[model samples]
Target: MMDQPATSRTIDTQCVVAGSGPGGLMLGLLLARAGVDVTVVEKHADFLRDFRGDTVHPSTLDIIDQLGLLEELLKVPHTQAPRLHAEIGGRDVTIADFSRLPTKCRFIAFMPQWDFLDFLAREARKLPNFHIVMSAEVTDLIEDGGRIAGLVARTPDGSVEIRAPLVVGADGRNSVVRAKAGLEVESFGAPSDVLWMKLSHQPDDPPYTMGHGGPRQGFVMVDRGDYWQCGYVVRKGSFAEVKEKGIEAFREAVAAVSPLPADRVGEIRSWDEVHLLSIRIDRLKSWWRPGLLCIGDAAHAMSPIGGFGVNLAIQDAVAAANILSVPLREDRLADRYLAAVEKRRAFPTKATQKLQLMMQSSSKKRQESATKRSGPPSFVRGIARWPFLAHLTGRLVGLGIRSEKVNMAALKAR
Candidate 1:
């Protein structure tokens, strides 16, 4: 156990951030850079796995560049998934073209989330004020007079009581800290379950591409060189059923919808290679309670649509860091920090959720229509023939759908 520094001890202000994922690590790094003694705790001991949410959006890349970690991140093996090719309203459109964006870091980079988390951890370690404890799980939060005071965590050796003025919950969707704080979250829509798997790629495999079959239907993103991230849509909680169907049936399903070559899909076998990601979004009415605040998935979990979960989590981390970088003793600093984070992220969260619902509903409709009709829908044919309507419909469903100006307005209102 490390003793509190003199500076931190003088004010009795210690910040404990739970979960050493990207959001928690970045939050710890930012706070430490601002001269705040921060400790980041994680349940996992190492970043070694294939997880979902690998695509880093351009907006998040901008923030990474702002933090001076862009150069280091680029050095890591990553695939630039710049074009979002989506089959919306039965017409294919590409949004988020790297050429159109003004920033030098305009492309969406596709790398494992673990790699991104590792990069953040490495950068955070450079700051002496930042400390990280792996293999330590936060089991309970310590409350003082209805405000968060610290946390009770179980390390490998034993349980330890760590004190802090502000406790941050960056611990993901199933956060123990949020539960301990007694925060109520409002969930939306039925759960969207995904059967995610990675296939080995030969050197001669075709170049990486993103292919979206329809709404509700899962898509594929080529990561690094030969490995392709593929997802299949299933009911809210039907992973076991899908798994029972076997890998061969799953490959046939992928071949039916995706643009990927049949040979690649054939390589996948066993449930071990396939990951099941059950997606749900919840928004807490209030992300702050006295001395505690929640960020990242702990604060709001959004749909995987647009791969905005990680980006949004990092965005919340950045916003929280900006607001809390000031002295905690400052009057209502915690209150202002919560308000700022909620304000900055609410619109983005809403926008992404709306998109997710739209895609889910549309995909269901398309599947139903496919079952009823022998051929493509008339509306799809109309759009395909009329290029003008195709572009217009694309803009409506795919391009510039979220207004940054409106989102910024919501942030300013807070």
Candidate 2:
């Protein structure tokens, strides 16, 4: 029980998880399956938001099959593409081929992120111990002797306090929980920011469902079936420059690189339709303090280079659940356990960030010397030439450096 004075303002549970994104929801769901009393608080009222991380990579699909949620989750609306393609020098080049990935599903499922989250949320709610509080935004950390014990949040009803043995910060990039806890983040600055928008896709449009990337000139288009989810990567802090060029010029630029008709770009209409994401490639140097631990986007903010951001977040959640659930249930959450979770995940996080930094460095080079810049670099084309190497690329993209397996062995099913 909480040592705080008896007050109705406080709600106690075994674990209090913040944020309802992929990582947050996944951690909560797995923890609940491990028979832990967990409460997930989300500031958003619903999961029906336009999310850019729509590619559910093969590794994540493998995890779903493990939980026996694959059949049911696949019942939701989604599209699948076996191979990821990119347009290089006007040639359709295969980047990461998922067709040969040895898994239950050898394709990336392109579903609305909301549908993915809702499916997980519905499954989570089936457990009596799992409770979700929506429209609840965490305002500050609840500390005792410099140790984080819980959090203070503003709910629709009133400001309430949640006290738990462990308080997990799974909030996004600008995590209030991470900030309030005084954790430090190290930055590996991104070379570009993403301008996300949607335009109606026509039957005559390019049939490449994996999307296209043209050096630094074109926008990446994913086939979301009805409306194409398009994102233009502008040199960091270049949105205003793009905006000042006039919408017509911007439309022409998009059409020059993408397969979309010039008139289709006009559907974007004005600058207001363009959503600017100040891309950040950073991660917390330290992920915890005492009774608090962080996972997912809270600990590391990834660049959307390979659509591995969401997959990485989900992997963090899986690793966290594997390590923390048992300790949390038995009331043995120590600083070392938190450190172990960090240690287990640190390698994958850094390795992925290292790859992203290399991409950013190359992008900066392309920006400085336009003459030297062309279609995708030589290595990207080299993989497509060799059939065997393309499959290896699929293995890396589909599975990642270290694929985490779920271990819920210590608790009884509720």
lDDT of 2 by residue, 1-414 (tens): 111222348888999999988899999999989988898988878887774687788999998998988999999989887887777666777777888777889988888988998888999988888988887889998888877888888876778898898999999899999999999999888778888888897888887864445566546778888888888878888899998999888878777766677778889888888788889989999998899998887999988756778888899999988888888887888899899999999999899888878767866776677676666544565765765676777887788878888884644533
Best by TM-score: 2
Stretches of model 2 off by over 4 angstroms after superposition: 1-8, 210-215, 384-387, 411-414
Error of 2 at 115 (Å): 0.8
Candidate 2 Cα lDDT to native:
0.82
* Model 1 collision count: 0
- On residues 1-414, what C-alpha lDDT tens digit does candidate 1 reach at each position? 232221231223368898877788878877777667788878777767666567766666766776667898999888875554544444465533454565556567888788888888877788777787777788888878877888887766677676888889999899999999999998885545777777766676545455555433556555557666777666688777776888788778777666557777777767677787778877788888887888878888866756667777777777777667665423245566667767877876777667666666655566667656432334444544564564344333222233221122222222
Cα error, residue 200 of model 1, in Å, equals 1.8
